[model samples]
Target: MQTPFKLSLSAQDIACERGGRTLFRNLDFAVEPGQALLVSGPNGAGKTSLLRQLAGLLPLAGGRLVTDGADADTPIAELSHYVGHLNAAKTAFTVRENLAFWADFLAEGQGDPADHLAGALAAFGLGELGRLPAGLLSAGQKRKLALSRLFAAPRPLWLLDEPSVSLDVASVKKLDGAMRDHLKAGGIAVVSTHVPLETKFTHTLDLGLERAA
Candidate 1:
């Protein structure tokens, strides 16, 4: 997949807060095109809050979030794909339906959404389970289904929070491959996870250390 335009994500002296408490302050990071940023921290260090801020789901407590090389009028959220802690699949819908819905809503490229459905499923080794109901899938399978959205629609920025949560070893490898392919295509990824991923990271931020200092 190719990005519609060149882009890079950067933050200067960013901070996060929840419940009137500051999590981290004076944090800085940059992710250029074709690079990944790995966020690590102990519990309550605000990894999820940081990702949410990047995704535009939460307001930044301080500092600026900047994207270079994109249109000034374009919102960062429109250029990003955020897969948070929860798998946003609708249980009653079939796996295919869930993916198809996301493909239609988040469509960016040419052709029909249906045309990308099968390929998305195949990308995550969920080819045969498309017909199954989403609720019937195991934890790992659901995670893959949620991840298939990356292939279903092409986006330059990916904000993934604990994406490896329920994935098995092989599934995690698949996830790594998908991320690698995205990076190879000049996409950027910001991921938060406790487990080590096979994906090669260009930069890493340890929120725990940031808070300690």
Candidate 2:
């Protein structure tokens, strides 16, 4: 059997700010392998900011973030995949090309790119659209292409901001299934979303409550 991936991520007394405004403070949460962290809050509650801090894209206003297991000394960006609200894809590239580029760029010595490429496309219902340019895809399809990167290169931590946005019901189910499989394989996911996602193990952190305190 393949050895399971181990991951431990925690935030303590964390704080974030944006646009000269304090979004949240003293936020804390721990995510373990085989589990998910669901971040929920009202608009401008710092949900996305918190995820960015964890992903190392934004500097924390206060407190420290800790990570254990699997290249602990490596920067969070190297060990995690951060998918923000925007679909980060090359509009000029075809679906296959986009996935292929990510698979190569983020290999991390994991599974074969060919396998990941095929699996990601199939997982997100994009197998038939692989040759189509990303810019031509519908909104939902663009979202799927963005999400396929998670599978294209297996990362231990996933920081997703509003991952379910623009997804159809069927696509949402697919996303849930992918998360379930990732957790089952000992991967960790931190998702900020208004849409409820069904997973086997989940922990929720409400940023609105953190902001109110």
Candidate 3:
């Protein structure tokens, strides 16, 4: 069994800029285990930028982002599963191959390979298309496959940007279930989306209105 670990994340006095234009500044929020932060805003409001910064993909223009109750030395990128707007799948690879690669690449010494792969495929309703080439999948199917990576690896933090994009109502519900399960397992998530995710343990951060004023 995996050892239990406490997880917490916070951003203090955060600021971000793109092309010399400030998107948001002085943003602050905190999320503990079993909790989620829902980031909502209009286009160009820096919702994606915030998630990228938290994922350690983009540099923080200003402020401190902290992760507590875990190994202090481990970077946020290593502890997080960042699902961006684009589906990070290899078009040439089969669905199973793409998922298998992620399962091993992001394993971080946790979860059984076979079990996690199977569970992820099933979770996204992609079991039957496992052998099909990813390039052939519909947009929704590719999104599902991309999201399945969260199930294939156990990460304490999830950084999602418009995760429900290209998904149907049923698939959206499945994504919600995945997020719910992640939170229940003591994982923290920061999601940037326009779609409302019906969950009881979510906190909202409206970058558009907050930053405009």
Candidate 2 lDDT for residue 33: 86
- lDDT (tens digit, per residue) of candidate 3 on 27-88: 98999899989888889999999989998989999999998998899999989989998899
lDDT of 2 by residue, 50-133 (tens): 888888889999999888886757887787889998888999999999999988778748767788788778889899999999
lDDT of 1 by residue, 1-213 (tens): 444437998999999889999999899988999999999999999999998999899999999999998888878898898998788999999998998888888885546787677678788888788789999999989989988988777778999999999898988898898888888888999999988898889899999999999
Q: Where does candidate 1 clash, by residue pair? A: none
Q: Candidate 3: lDDT over CA atoms?
A: 0.87
Can you give the lDDT of residue 43 in candidate 3?
93
- Per-prediction TM-score: 0.95, 0.95, 0.95
Lowest lDDT sum, 10 consecutive residues, model 2, at: 1-10
User: Stretches of candidate 1 above 4 Å error?
Assistant: 1-5, 108-111
